[model samples]
Target: MATSAATPHNKIIGQRELVVIVALLMSLNALAIDAMLPALGQMAAELNVQDGNRRQLVVAVYLLANGLGCLLPGSLADRFGRRPVLFVSLAAYAACSLLIAAIHSFEVLLALRGIQGVLCAGLMVVPTAIIRDQYEGDKMARLMSLVSAVFITVPVIAPSLGQGVLLFAGWRWIFILFAVVAAVTGLWVWLRLPETLHPENRQRVELPVVLRNMRTGLLNRGAIGYVLGAGLLVGAVFGYVNSAQQLLGEHFGVGEWFPLVFGGTAAMMAVSNIVNSRIVERFGARRVSHAGVLTFIVVSAAQVWAAHYRPGELAVFLPLMATNLMLLGFLGANFGSIAMQPFARIAGAASSVQTFCRMFGAAVVGLLIGQAYDGSARPFAHALLMCSVSALVLVLFSEKGRLFRRLNPPRQQQPAGPPPV
Candidate 1:
């Protein structure tokens, strides 16, 4: 568990290769979700979905499955080793993508998409455990921010990519692309990526032990508080993502330009993440996260006010929404890294727990916001404002009401104590 010892274990991949692989693996989740944004209407029309609200299910179901299914990968990775678990999950993900393309039934597509989402959970959990395997505290935050900066490119390009594919090809071709990407990535990983989970660190595959570790992670105030807090904060992003196509196309009448608007917002997030990777090392995760959340709250509040007065205007709405998302990039990576600080010894299960909490919580928030679509941006903006305030409260409570304080420094052995209740 020494940072000194972890250095060598992590060095095999080298920094640049490690970043690239981790970014791609992590982006699988984003790519799968975002790439289908432009085609949601087309998909629904082709599939004969008359209710507009139900169309968002194409996005929501995947997230729901992702949250529920993430429960397995961490425990399995801790037991089996990262490489094998990853390969299996990636193969399943690829298979699902391939299979979904040929299936025409909407109900069946959702079911298969759920299965694919579950498979994608492995893509989500293992890389974090591997990163936790290498770094801790602020350094881990920095690395995660960088990974996110790289990973955000998927969101930036995926909708546009989806739009591009839809130009000459049917929507089902999107899944074909997913199949191709997953297969190629699976091969690349199998051939190039070595197992990062060390033999000495492997845990016995036992349900009771997994539950106990998850309980411990939940009971730890810093971990659980941030888990809930960051999860709620992340819910704002998911809410926007789920409703983005409609909010742009229906409310703002951007229609075919929805991908461009969405991509531009995502690009801002990428820039902020790049900046976050640089500044988090110096400011510490706590200070940066605290400031970031406050910024998120202010932006959310302003968005609500702006949407109230300029509700129908595209010019005003897009910039504020983009700014809010850009600021969110600073919060997500650091919050997760901070939450994982207490779980070095059990990063697999801990990562699973965190992913579950974040994704499920986000799913609930997103579903509500998406369902509340009233042909205006107010519902989304109001949801953002509410989630931002809720997140700030949970984060404040997690820190025992002390903002901008770092309780654990990078590479330091964590002191044992009960967290603030």
Candidate 2:
């Protein structure tokens, strides 16, 4: 198939609308996860869940399914086009969210949440591919950072939103809100989003063809390491989220202040991403992220000490943890853009595979961290340090022991070649 020309409608989408639309699409995933945090205890108790750690399954199960679900949409989007695929997903996602709200059985609820996760996977994969269709290199990093800056606000406010809903109605209303948001966003995309995948790039959605594209993406030296490293680091964030309610609410006895405390760290992340969007084009993604990770490791080490030495002190723990999360704002967008740099031709499949690795891996690590809760922040802090050090190691391996060296300008849709055995 030869490449198709973009429609005149594509030109009508100004950059500001594009950024907001993309950010809202991505924020759907964040909102679904974060908004449920305040309601976890009530949901668990009502559903007859006895174990505290198991309450996290409300989240962990969704995350695991979300990651696994990412495997299909990209390849399908590559074949069918981004617009149709996304529309189907958004519709199903809204329906699924409503179904989860109306269900009473725990088993049925988990199954519904799993179904919703799979539907929402397209939310994660398609918008990312849409962004890649428009930008690359440091410019791509800058755009992603801006998207992230906007998207980060959902996590910052979602818990508080959930808490407010809990005060007025049952936890089920939270899912009702999710459905409303999905419907509204879906309408916006239907009205505004043009198909981004070129006709020439459309490939057969055959099993073998999809596997081959994914295999090629995973084999790229320039991308694979960052994919893996980013997954490891992102695991730390997931861990914090999984443990946050227990850590701040019960362990530290912050009680109703959990949402405020949670929002503070997320607010810092939003600021950091805003700064990164402004600076990444000038400094290069490599230099900025390398410095960010090094700083992350240092702050994480201090976090470990604080958790142990000042174990009961909320004043000491909050600021250090906030700084660590703030650093993640620098790491996520840059690492993601660099990983996607070599996959211009297969952005859909590439995005799907990389997202699967990052999300599934992070979900499992987060589940472990959540289950490890023992009324102190030491385990969480230690996990963060371990993940950061391991991430730096993988990054070094990816760069062949180099750090802060500038990546060459973007190439044509070509492979970055295979890594050494």
Candidate with the greatest lDDT versus the true structure: 2
Weakest lDDT window of 10 consecutive positions for candidate 2: 412-421
TM-score for predicted model 1 compared with the true structure: 0.94
- Candidate 1 stretches greater than 4 Å from native: 1-11, 410-421
Error of 2 at 47 (Å): 1.3
TM-score of each candidate structure, all chains considered together: 0.94, 0.96
lDDT of 1 by residue, 1-421 (tens): 2332323245355776788898999898899999999999889989899998899998999998988888889988877777887888888888998898898889999999898988789898899998998888899999999999999999999999999999999999999999899888887786767677766566766667778777765667777778888778777788888888878888889877888888998899899999999999888988998898898888888888978898889999888888888888888999899888877767888899888988888888888888888888888888888888888898878888889886655342321232111
What CA RMSD would you report for each candidate? 3.7, 3.4
Model 1 lDDT-worst window of ten: 412-421
Candidate 2, position 170, lDDT: 96
lDDT of each: 0.84, 0.87
Once fitted onto the true fold, the runs of candidate 2 whose alpha carbons sit more than 4 angstroms away are 1-11, 413-421
